[model samples]
Target: MKKMLLIFSFIIFVFNLLTAQEKEKAQPTPANKVLSKYTKEFAVSLLKGVDDSMYPKIFKAKMSMETIRKGRNPIKFVYEVYSKGSTKSLMEIVFPARDKGKKILLLDNNLWMYVPDVSRPIRLSRNQSFMGSTFSNEDVSDSTWEDDYDPEITDEKGDKILLTLKAKRRDVAYKQIDMWVNKETKVPIEGVYYGLSDKPIKKIYFFNVKEIAGLLRPLDMRMADLLEEGAYTDVKLLELKELESVPDYKFDITQLGR
Candidate 1:
């Protein structure tokens, strides 16, 4: 009887050990949970006007790019933008007769420009200017932070949360970005982009907050170059719409000319 009792006790101990191990596996690690929360918040803040749908969201907008500089007439270009989700977009110059039929395509991380005069689309670097404006190809492209950046909350002030974002891959335009977001609305108020040297190269401000569709988003975005004096670009969204579906071919490079 003593031997049987001892054997039963050993069995119970082993079972308890196994159950504890299973519980540990089921619970998420603290580090991972923290990172996941930051990522979710960053994604929501970055893609403000987008819906939480598996399908891509489409936005149609009239964009006015105005460059503020000294000794040069304030250059303005009007464009019709078609954006799909946070990965693909196409912009066509509409008002300016000289630039009509010119198209800019953002497919994944690649940017291409198709001009009526050029036989084929010219691949553009993310750092390149968008139509000679202060906005870079990367700036105009629609992309989510979760895919390209890893974010962490560095500080929480009264009404804002400061987030530091590091690029997950080298292909990203900016190596690092420091952003201040509204804690209650999850709207990005300001962002500073840093180069590989960890120095700020550009700053962006989000303003004119309003509700479009069901999401609250900033209607105006202004970017200022840190190195350039009195040079900045302001982009205002005249119209925005979310689409139910966008055909995949619209983002294809081959269809850019059409």
Candidate 2:
């Protein structure tokens, strides 16, 4: 009887494991929003270019983020980031001793935080502030915008493409975004984020463009809180190394804190 029970438990564990892996492979929800300008082929091509330029398929990097407020001293955090494809990423705090050993993971479109003392990881909301920074949790994770938004070409300025993205589903962190993309590079330049009410809530500016992995990529970005003046978080990618591949088990949520 004990052997049968043990086998049953093993089966359950395998089922749960497969379920989670399948969830990570889920496709993007289709957009119901109106797209006035983008053609099917062109839109797909543009979004692909943007995603590719955003980050490499597999990489490990060191980064720093500084949050500056109106009157308070700037708060800084350093992290070692690892990403696999567009779906899995893990970041570990390596600086500001107090936050050391804390980790953040993104998997299957969900965000989680793992602390040294916490028995289990805690699920986090996508729209919530990330460690009290101006950047939202979604801003830190959710790198695959193409999976969550439908694109429309609204306008163009010299050397820039004004692309507007409408959320494909209601659960996304932002309802709409008007982005400025480099015409030649297809990399994002600047963007304004909006909420469900269509009110502009935040803005992001990407800078420090340099060649990485044979493509020009932004190594630094500033996220501005439109609701509060003089509040912004600057994220800098201090080091990056492209990898041919990363071990899949490294992104497993169950192995996160271990």
- Write one digit per residue (lDDT tens) for candidate 1, span 17-78: 99999977554312212334456566445434122211136767777888887778887888
Q: Estimate each model's TM-score.
A: 0.77, 0.83
lDDT of 2 by residue, 122-208 (tens): 999988999989988888883688888888776777888777788898878899888889878988999988877667788999998
Give each model's whole-structure lDDT: 0.74, 0.85
In the predicted model 1, the residue pairs found to clash are 86-142
* Residue 190 displacement (Å), model 2: 0.6
In model 2, how many backbone clashes occur?
0
Query: How much is 124 displaced in model 2, in angstroms?
Result: 0.4
Estimate the overall C-alpha local distance difference test score of candidate 2.
0.85
